[model samples]
Target: MSIQPVSRERHAHLRWKGFSSFAFAASTTLAPLAAAEISQAALALPLAFIERDGHWSMAAVLGLMPGQNLYVDAGGVWLGRYIPAALRGYPFLIGARADSEPPPCIDASSGLVTPGEGEPFFDEAGSLSPTVTQVMRFLEQTAQSEATLVDACETLASFAVLEA
Candidate 1:
């Protein structure tokens, strides 16, 4: 995949308690791209870190509106350890079509679908009802599949929000 190079000098500083980190956080800029890719509005914008080249690399694929606790270090050293936590509490999704079985659920209202199953869910902001349970069963039966329940949950959550 081609990536555009950014710069540390142009990065923003995020202050948390007595500690501070430098990174970039912009949902408006990348959210649309993700939405287009996933074909859902409930895509999760997982945490990302600024690489040495100043380009962005996702630290982790956070599920639907996952809390700040899910945020973790991107496994880097020194100054490069900094990662943008702004999206920790923000909403993001996989923004892609499911390639596995037990397809994610969707909110008829929002017209968005969860990325997969076994993913996290927030409040009504992103909820999965009967559909979620079915997805769960599918995940339990499948083994060694690249697909994750979390991805399905993210897909459903995305759809819910889109309908809302």
Candidate 2:
């Protein structure tokens, strides 16, 4: 199958309604950083690139968010080496999955975001998206600079798929 260029302009704001201690921190902090909400529209065609059964024949939601940046390692791990001071207080992973798998979960008292609910999730990629692979590729190209958290956040924002 031909690889279709994915658009990365679909910005969305995910109102995390799940329960978590981290929720409080995100709401208090991220709520202010967010600019707009893509809750009313779908991702652009380019960013809408999907492959199910070797073709672009699938139904999904693509959303976005503007807040703390996130980054994942080349080996599907969140590197917690150099987190920004602004986001250090929060539970942002360096290279980790965004699903509720335990250590990655938001503290009930802090905040909570679930895949397809508050956070982004790919049924095929789990909490990761095709963009994750793209980010990994980008990381591969530029291995000098430590992976930027904003890179992951921006990419994740471009692929935040909402549920029907």
- Candidate topping TM-score: 2
- 32-96 per-residue lDDT for model 2 (tens digits): 11012112112321123233333221211212344332333334233333222223223222233
lDDT (C-alpha, whole model) for all candidates: 0.28, 0.29
Please name the candidate that would achieve the greatest lDDT relative to the true structure.
Answer: 2
Off by over 4 Å in 2: 1-91, 95-109, 125-127, 130-164
Off-target runs (Cα >4 Å) in candidate 1 are: 1-79, 90-115, 120-164
